[model samples]
Target: MKERRHFIRIVYQAPAQLSQSGAQWSATLKDISLHGILLSCPDGWQPGDDPEFQVDIVLPETDVHLTMTAELVAYDPQSLRMKIVNIDIDSISHLRRLIELNIGDDALLHRELEHLADLAEDE
Candidate 1:
């Protein structure tokens, strides 16, 4: 199989809530990258079910909250994974900084961001 992701993932044991309308569940973060997040929920979910995620990250210096809507990518009996298809500018900026700091690789982060910017400019 070919590697298809643009960002590196790392174990991020954060608390997040997934919700759609009246349906909701709290889950532990399994792994995260700049583009997607993998979580272990109590139950399975379906693809095409647009859901909103709110992840709370508290640090000693400051606290950050990310609220974004994502599209379901894969799901199993106990795990739910989604691609961050859409996010607000503020949240995306925060996420980018978070990943850069956690990954400890500013150079790599800059390259990726430049690539994304070039693609967007081409569009």
Candidate 2:
């Protein structure tokens, strides 16, 4: 089945948190869409659990900073990976633009293109 959600995957090293007073953890963003983002952090989160976090995403071309809140969505013990969900879309547009620019030629971009075409056709 085709992926219903479109995401731009990128790898970056940044500081993230699970709570206001929680410990800071290093994380790598896996993918991002208009509404949310997915990231991999150290093995410290559980499925269905929500943990607030902040992440700084560097724009690819401009090196601009985009910071936003993220919530823990899932965790894998075998890979020691945590999937984070970003909630702030407006605050991260620059980062998304950077990702789109970098990923314009990728297969994932084609998928997103197809999804957009479908949406347009539906409308």
Best by TM-score: 1
Question: For candidate 1, lDDT tens digit of each residue in 1-123?
Answer: 999877688777777777776667677778877778887864554443445544433323456777777656777877777777667787788878777888888899888788767756876
Q: How many Å off is the CA of 48 in candidate 1?
A: 7.5
Best by lDDT: 1
| Candidate 2 displacement at residue 65 in angstroms | 2.1
Q: For candidate 1, report its TM-score.
A: 0.77
Give the distance in Å from residue 89's predicted Cα in candidate 2 to where it truly belongs: 8.1
Error of 2 at 120 (Å): 18
lDDT score for candidate 2 against the true structure: 0.53
Report the C-alpha lDDT of model 2 over 5-122, residue by residue, as the tens digit.
4455555443333333455555555556544555564566444433566666554455466676755444565322323344355554565565577676657666765664575577
**88, model 2: CA deviation in Å?**
6.6
lDDT of each: 0.70, 0.53
Q: What clash count goes with each model?
A: 0, 0
- Candidate 2 — which pairs collide? none
Worst 10 residues of 1 by lDDT: 53-62
Candidate 2: worst-modelled 10 consecutive residues by lDDT: 78-87
Error of 1 at 24 (Å): 1.2
TM-score of each: 0.77, 0.50
